[model samples]
Target chain A: MARVHDMGGLPNQGRIVMDKDEHPFHADWEARMWGMNEAMWGPDSWTLDWWRYVRELIQRDDYLTRPYFDQWMQVYAAMMVDSGVATVAEIASGKSDGSRPKGAVLMHAADVAKAAATTRDFRRPADQKPAFTPGDKVHTKTLGEGFHTRLPSYLMNKTGIVHAHRGNHLLPDAGAKGAEVAQHLYTITFAGADLWPGEGRDKDRFNADLWESYLERA
Target chain B: MSSSYDPKKITEIHEHLHSELPSDPALRVKALESLLVEKGMVDSAAIDAWVDLYAEEIGPKRGARVVAKSWTDPTFRARLLADGTAAISEFGYQGHATGHIVAVENTPGVHNLVVCTLCSCYPFALLGMSPGWYKSQEYRARAVRDPRGVLKEFGVSVGDEVEVRVWDSTAELRYLVVPERPAGTEGLSEDQLAALVTRNSMIGTDRVLKKAG
Candidate 1:
């Protein structure tokens, strides 16, 4: 089934609210939610792909209606329970049972500054040559059944030109399963009309970063 | 306490009480935080630090500074277009969500807009936290399909000769649209130029300088 998160090209989405004085957080709780999500980061943290996949698993109605940070709160609670870092009852009651898993290292307040400053490099050493190059015409493949994929449904089975070869990076399909697999990535540029026939303008174009696995020679 | 027995007044008081109660999600977040802190799994102070980092230290100002420098320095502009991550690191502004940065330039004949259809992937390290509109369903759904129409709503009208390019951040690479240097700013300093760059311009929703004004 197509996931709710793959929302590109779906119609009837309302007007975007433009506020010049927009701050990142509207309330203290929103800030706390953002901070809590960041504080959970560590060497053994879950892959962002997994985090996104879990979010997509939310029921469609709730997924569409819930505020952004509220969705994050739901996903974080589920992840904590799934990873055995916390219990559902404990979370609901706001009390711990005084039991923690072995080898759990608490993230200290003092180290957060250092952690936030550090850059996380997602690129990995390539194991094979790139399958496509810039200026080459390629067709995006329809993705098979997978719990997580970065390919938006709108771009599937469309023809585009490889604009640039971005070096090997962690494949999110595998990363969501707790495996780190690198694949050649490229910036694929498609004519706007190709993505949406009558709706797109003649001169408009769209670009997406696609893994080699998602494309083939046209 | 006065025994006010009017049914309408009692109903109004009931509605106010319900409205004043914390939302379900908010209460859930508070509960989760309390549980994690009680279990020694996370520090409350650490959470505050994370908030302060984005709220105070980092944001669009960093991107504005880079944009300003790129406008004035030919060497820096070339370096930024060639290798965004490296050029951004030269300013000591490299961090999370900016691992593979791609700087796309806007030209007189071309415009660049960005969206994340699958998720809201942004270069937080450089541009700071994303604006709410950038992550909305309307922008993500329509940016790639009818970009000209979407831009019109943002009050930006691209000419027929100008091509609009929408970058959908589907993978690791994060994009920073280098907006066109506005006209009539030749006498302004780099700092002044940086001040002219708005967050919406960097996100491709608004023009850095309006054509009329």
Candidate 2:
């Protein structure tokens, strides 16, 4: 979906705030949200891409206005309800009405050691040859809305040259839908003039890691 | 030295938003956790441990060590610039959000900065969690559009002669900027050099300042 979250080079975004001494989690709730997010992401739980899709499902107005962690909290609460872990009444009442879902693993304290040891690897050996190699000119295919996509709205249909072939990795689009499909990834470099002609310097360049499905020959 | 929001302004915004919610954020989070625990849905201890791991054990120190070692070891530097995942793993910092690491060097003529304009996708295993300003909407929207301008606000003044390369982290590959080592520190040990490497420098927002005598 081309939501407000994909705001890369839009105008009037104001200046980047220089918070020299800022903490990662501004408030206690933010820390709790972070911890919960980590705890919920186990082998049996939702993938990061799935969580991102849940976040993208938030109403556009709230998605745009809420603070960073607030957005996380909102999406998490919604997921809890959507996945049947909790209900609307349970969250609003600040108490569980004894209607919790089953088979969630619970993520007990004993499980922390095992969970911490788990590692996620995106690479998968494949026989398919990479479509684009280093120095290959390519253009990103314009994609339609209504699905989880890693292709940024700013770079859609834009032309770029392949800078490097980053080995095959699980496609995020498939990962979001609970399926893992290995695809070639590349670091494509776009001229600053192409992304933002007058705003950016001519010498400057922007690079993005794009999957094979999102690219085609120029 | 510069901040777009002051405490007073933040307090005002908090108060305005506070009126809409039933309780404070801290208390609300506590309540939510308690409710989840009451129903045997979550383990509070696990949450605490997870937070501690990020806050204490994993951090930019790991990244600083990698930078410092690369500065002194030519072969390691070459491997790091070539295959960052395998190179960084020499220090035992790999796996989890580190699918395909790419180390971009900051040379005399070019500078590299990393950002996930769509969301906050960072190398958590190596750098721990991201900073607050990194995930801010303002930073996400403006970093790619005007990197030098953003860097200047962070007190990082890149010269007009140099080129700025902004890496928009759109995929699973994580990027780390090997900032140019400051001069006048030829005699310093690797540990001392690592001390000079700041998290902001690796993120390409600021440079490693010279060691003060």
Candidate 3:
């Protein structure tokens, strides 16, 4: 795809082009990943847990622009930084976290283990009992003139019905919106026309998991 | 330290995390060290958890199936257009999903498109999983700004005479569009008919079971 501009033979083509490295993904990562997944999990390896991650991330807008190796590098960097093996400076500078590292890490190896054991993967329960049943019309609550929501910007103030009940979830939106939210929020279905006005396709539709705090009687 | 590292060893170490035991809960450390030696990226277990949560029904292919079936059955189609949830549940498919459903039917005069300007809220249970492109921010942003332009890029042409209805799947309900089948597929079996329906058809770019191509 990047070659298209070069084919134009126009001046400043180099300047106009974006290098693959500036983004994510190494050219060989796919081959290596495919091999590993195939060897370990078989042909359907991607169809299972691994592929889901790939599909979700690949759908992100940055996938095309990101370099292949860089993608792996970034993921590697994030996991390390997150798990406390490296610091931001070490990652940014390409310096080694060989011995000692800087900065305050809330949880190192031992700490992370203890936390993991005790904390629980809170969001793990998405298939629990739903507070609302299908066919129920619910109105989105408009809390008094102030900013608040576990709902995404697109779903706020929209009316929808309960199409399904996933049980429970961590309710990230509620967490983000500062709600005293219980985990395992309900998954609801909103109408396409209701969500987007002119843009709603005649046949296009969608659904999302939401917290109780973001909804009310419609 | 400027050191020459063999990426092969890093890959080896990564594979080790799985075969090895958790005597020290060392998945994180192993990941950290391997990353230091090699250049690679991987989704964390948190990502895996989300993927595990994803269901196939919400995937594009199965989503396309639902739309195609609705096209084949008028009574169901009408029910779907009127009340999508009831229509779909009649076929025994109403689990783990939430909110209402709206069925948008494609017609000679109308074309439909789906997008979630917010985040990706697809039906994972039934659809398997989404393609790498559906949850994209590009799809979300561009689908809203220029539905025609974006669809065109994907080879979906909207004639000037056709009224394009863009359906935004928000955090509330899901919308699945039923596209009318093309000519010359009269005696085809449902499975045969299904073969012609691509995931892109459900998204409103390409279509299903056309006459020739």
lDDT of 3 by residue, B57-117 (tens): 2344455556667657777677777776666566545533423555667788877777665
DockQ of each: 0.31, 0.30, 0.07
Off by over 4 Å in 1: A42-45, B1-23, B210-213
- Highest TM-score: which candidate? 1
Which ten residues in a row are the worst by lDDT in model 3 chain A? Answer: A1-10
DockQ ranking, high to low: 1, 2, 3
- Which ten residues in a row are the worst by lDDT in model 2 chain A? A39-48
Query: RMSD in Å for candidate 2, one decimal?
Result: 7.1
lDDT (10s digit) by residue, model 2, range B69-175: 99999999999998888897787787557757889999989988899988898988788878878887888888888888888888888888889999999988889
Which consecutive 10 residues in model 1 chain B have the weakest lDDT in total? B1-10
Q: Candidates' interface RMSDs, in order?
A: 11.4, 9.0, 15.4
Per-residue lDDT, model 1, residue B149, is: 84
Q: Candidate 1 on A99-168: residue-level lDDT in tens? A: 8655556777798777776787788999799999899999999986546889889999999999999999
lDDT of 2 by residue, A1-218 (tens): 35767878776877776666656556668888778767764334465676687666656666677667776765555556545566555665568887655655668666765665455678889779999899999999988766678999889999999999888988888776667688998999999889888874787889999999999999
Against the reference, the lDDT scores of all candidates come to 0.81, 0.77, 0.46
TM-score of chain B of each: 0.86, 0.84, 0.68
TM accuracy, model 1? 0.92
